[model samples]
Target chain A: MTFPADLVGLLALLGALFVLLGSLGIVKLSSYLLRLHAATKASTLGVGAILLASALHFSARDGGASLIEVLAAILLFATVPVSAQMLARAALHLHPDLAPPQPDSGSRQTVPEGAEVARPNHGNSAPADRL
Target chain B: MIAIAMFITGAAMLLAALRLLLGPTIEDRVLALDTLYVDALALLVLMGIALESRVYFETALVMAVLGFVATVAVAAYLRRGRIMP
Candidate 1:
């Protein structure tokens, strides 16, 4: 009922809206990568906003700044991208077919057959086992 | 107003669960689960505000750590067919 309460409510509402939109994208998006984009980026922002609201509300109520929510926000922001990257790499390793076709570039350099870059196979039997 | 936010966040979790159930690939399911937990974190924070309690914030923090570890472990398994190898 106070100004701070109103602000908290507004921030919470906006955050929830963003979260819902992200989940909707997860369900509605046609491609796996696109869904990843939605899940990681949008939901991170949404949760960050919600955490901000939480911090604000507690700080106002306690008459002192609450930084716990800020810590949570920092953790969320730091980890979301790491998890997203790992998930994407896993998806690519397991299901390379899901990747969109590479756009043909006119100036793309063709690597010499024997000069291709060496990458760790992560226990796969052969170097060229899977993309 | 907090109630409305809670309702919306619950709906978002439901949608994420739907994706988790019907996802076409393992990665999609993992991603859905990831989103679901993030939404849960937000909901828990909202609940904290609504109840005027700070206890929920600690639980939310733990959830964030656990969720990150779970997602990463699953992703590593998917890629290597083993988590540690």
Candidate 2:
């Protein structure tokens, strides 16, 4: 789509930021489930924003191509989440063990006189849930 | 206009791929793949606009469908050790 110099730069920058965030999530998260959440959310936002900007830019430049522009955004909205969810479900399947083990939050305990109560022992598995 | 964005987007995709390759577990790779699909789709659309051709959108749509199916199929296979499971 043809856009003025300033506007095109701005749109591109915004789009890039969105994509960057999505990519960043991959490295930052600890587990597959967490990574899936971050990756999918950021990617959707990134692509959605960029496409939206593109649609606007294109519409402003040429009136006739408006339909295509709208379609672009719609397609992004409809497809990204579904695919991401599917992938995430698959990932959990692939590595059932990858799901974060539940955290062992110690049971509530009264402090003994001059002695600290011991936290609940997490035996073998960490006590925690996933993202 | 699109050239710069495409470059950046492509770079970001590579960064995500780095995680995909190095992830400690199979699930991590799947998450990376999910992100990759999104990035690829975005690139497809941007390319369409850059080249001024609606033809790219068709490819993008096919990508959307194909990626979803593949992901779902893979997930099923992983979950139960069988496709139906």
Candidate 3:
């Protein structure tokens, strides 16, 4: 059970590159939401690749497939989206102005008219009001 | 190869830290922290490969779990002004 060192190295390198790019996006992106988009999607893929490399390297060295790495990867995949969604919603709630404007002529109206009227006032109240 | 991977991840972590420091809003800082932990997880896995040890994997696993919980809790607090209802 010998994994090729070259293959493991390549996977790790690729994963690290993806992680670097994602972090770069976090610093360079103009808005918090776009940064969130980069951080969750890119870094998850990056970490997943790194975990695969780890499993492969260790499985080869120990003569047994390492499944714990797989578990970690799965945990990461499952949790990242939930956290990202929560963060995005929190951002929207805290800063209503950050929300994108609705189109003038849309086939479907996502936000009701009354809610739209009330949204601006939300910013005026202290955030603790929602608690 | 492992060294290179570790270096890249380290750089990524540094970039995330920069965002954490310079982020204009609380949400941006939260996002940066989230990215930072994920980068740390990647680095730990890379370190495990470099050291030829399985022990680091468990640490990485714990880190991933804790990081997720922390991110979610902060986000919940920010959204509703309370973590637990």
Steric clashes per prediction: 0, 7, 0
For model 1, state the Cα shift of residue A84 in Å: 0.3
The C-alpha interface RMSD of every prediction is 0.5, 2.3, 0.6
**Model 3, B40-65: lDDT tens per residue?**
99998898899887788888888999
Location of the lowest summed lDDT over 10 successive residues in candidate 3 chain A: A114-123
TM-score for candidate 3: 0.85
Q: Could you tell which candidate, 1 or 2, scores higher by TM-score?
A: 1
Q: Of 2 and 3, which scores higher on TM-score?
A: 3
Ranking by TM-score: 1, 3, 2
DockQ each: 0.75, 0.55, 0.74
Model 2 C-alpha lDDT per residue in residues B2-22, reported as the tens digit of each score: 788889889889988999899
Against the true structure, what is model 1's DockQ? 0.75
Q: How much is the lDDT of residue A121 in candidate 2?
A: 57
lDDT string, candidate 1, A8-84, tens digits: 99999999999998999999999999999998998888898899999899899888999999999999999999999
lDDT of 1 by residue, B1-85 (tens): 9999999999999999999999988888899999988999999999999999999988999999999999999999988889997
How would the docking of model 1 be graded?
A: medium
Report how far off residue B19 is in candidate 3 (Å).
0.5
Q: What is the TM-score of each predicted model, taking all chains together?
A: 0.86, 0.73, 0.85
